[model samples]
Target: MEEILSQNEIDVLLSAITSGEMDAEELKKEEEEKKIRVYDFKRALRFSKDQIRSISRIHENYARMLTTFLSSQLRTYVHIGVESVDQVPYEEFIRSISSLTVLNIYSMSPLKGSMVIEINPNVAYALLDRILGGKGTSVTKTESLTEIEKILLNQIFEKATGTLKEAWSSLVDVSPVLEEFEENPQFIQMVAPNDTVVVVSMSAEIGEASGMINLCIPHTLLEPIIPKLSAHYWMDNTTDERDEEAFQKLSSNLQTTKVDVQAILGETRITINEFLKLGINDVVSLEQQIGDPLTLTINQEPKFYVQPGQLKKKIAVQILEEIEKGVNTHE
Candidate 1:
């Protein structure tokens, strides 16, 4: 199968080299300089760089929201921020994490497939400890979570799904729900090993504990709304004018909302025996004098002082003044 150069052909090459028409060093350098880039078909890129950047922006907002939620719920200082967003093969994503960790398989409705939220064991244990009235610290090692730990984690992440929904609201209205839980990453089979996924890596610091939280969104799950992830779509919808309009609409609806209002004439404490012996015609003394102002309450909150009076033969209470601000008038 090898073709060898004839003596006359080789002699021609030597003549060309000797005549300065060809340089042997230049030929060798040219062969060495040829660049060959390898492309693997299985690890193909499914998301464009622009789309990846958009996803990163969405998760950045998610990180801030999660930080606030966690800090408030745990009553500790929590900081979370987006570390990176990358598109890689599903198998590579799964292999990068620990074998034993918290895997929350959740579904984003209106999308066909499910997504995953992988929590490092340290972070999970830290949160669990904080929730159970301990300092936010984790053990040096980790193991599979118990049934009670799983239930608490479920509740925590179930509430966290709200932040995910809000983050994607600018692109699409997605209701994410926790569907299943697994400790081993290999047990997750939402997508094929060769499938492409966009992973959002976040660095979370909760009190004394710090670790990474990863959100793996398979390409198939985003394929349906891929067009909405464009920069143009995001820019057009997330305008200040749209937000102002929504705010005005909400304000208008609230202005017309009805609330319960009650007027309290006075209060008096009576013995159980006296209360049982009271009759319809008997008069009982109240704490307030005859001309004392009555308290007006709205939605069970004491909000104003009023005067009990009569208008057109109907008893009514007229608002005298508002209760002092920032003071608990309920007492």
Candidate 2:
């Protein structure tokens, strides 16, 4: 029999189609999930959230490495930190540095252009004094730095670059090659004047002396590596590798556990009366051949058969074969 829907049912169908409620609700749900994060192009939105997170983590590592490196180099306790990671116009970054500063121009390969790292003159002079065998002290603002001081500063910046290389190793291999050294900010231009840059501002403190650091990484140079700069990309690719590494470490630790080992040369049975009447030099024969290998046990389990030997001045055993449970090869 053919069944027909009631008029009320037909009206309900028409109402839903007219209102577009069914698909509209589903479409709204999917779109809402996709649009959760709000992005702003005004702040130079070249770096996504994941990219920012990765950059921050990497820079923290750099701060720690630089802290240890400088502390050891200057023979004193030093502290360095990543204060902020931000994006701004190259001009703004240029304007932020002091008139007298140490600017390190460097390049990262596979990247288009160069970057800048600025160290406060106070910190530079402090490092120079320490390197020259003087007590690290806060230096007064000087009108100018000499050519010799510039040369010494070059070596210091080189160490900073080395630390940056190590910090980026887990994410990607990078080599920071120095391009130039400049004291005047106006004369330095690694990229266009108004281009966007990722500026990593940091702070350094040694004893009572303290100063700031700034790194200007141009956006154009970092554009090519956008896909690799995200958090999800690394977490997905390295999870299994981390698990394997942890497992290997655990297994290696287990290999170092101590075990008690002893060898049984032979076995013998004696009567109680004979035991009581035994003398100091009394001879008792054991159920073993003169040249037979001894059974070695580890933690109460028979593990190997070995022959008695003398190694230098110590008694030792040469392993003849591995022993299995309930199996006697010699017999």
Q: Highest lDDT among the candidates is held by which one?
A: 1
* Clash number by candidate, in order: 0, 0
- Candidate 2 lDDT over residue span 46-99, tens digit each: 777678778888899999999998988889768999999988888888888888
Please list the C-alpha lDDT of all candidates, in the order they appear.
Answer: 0.89, 0.84
Instruction: Please report, as a residue range, the 10-residue window in candidate 2 with the lowest summed lDDT.
Output: 38-47
Q: Mind giving the per-residue lDDT tens digits that candidate 1 earns over 237-328?
A: 76646578888999999999999999987889999999999998999998987766888999998899899889999999898778987874
Give me the displacement of residue 319 in model 1, in angstroms: 30
Error of 2 at 305 (Å): 35
Off by over 4 Å in 2: 1-43, 242-331
Predicted structure with the largest TM-score when compared to the true one: 1
Clashing pairs in 1: none
Give TM-scores for every candidate, taking all chains together and pairing residue i with residue i: 0.66, 0.62
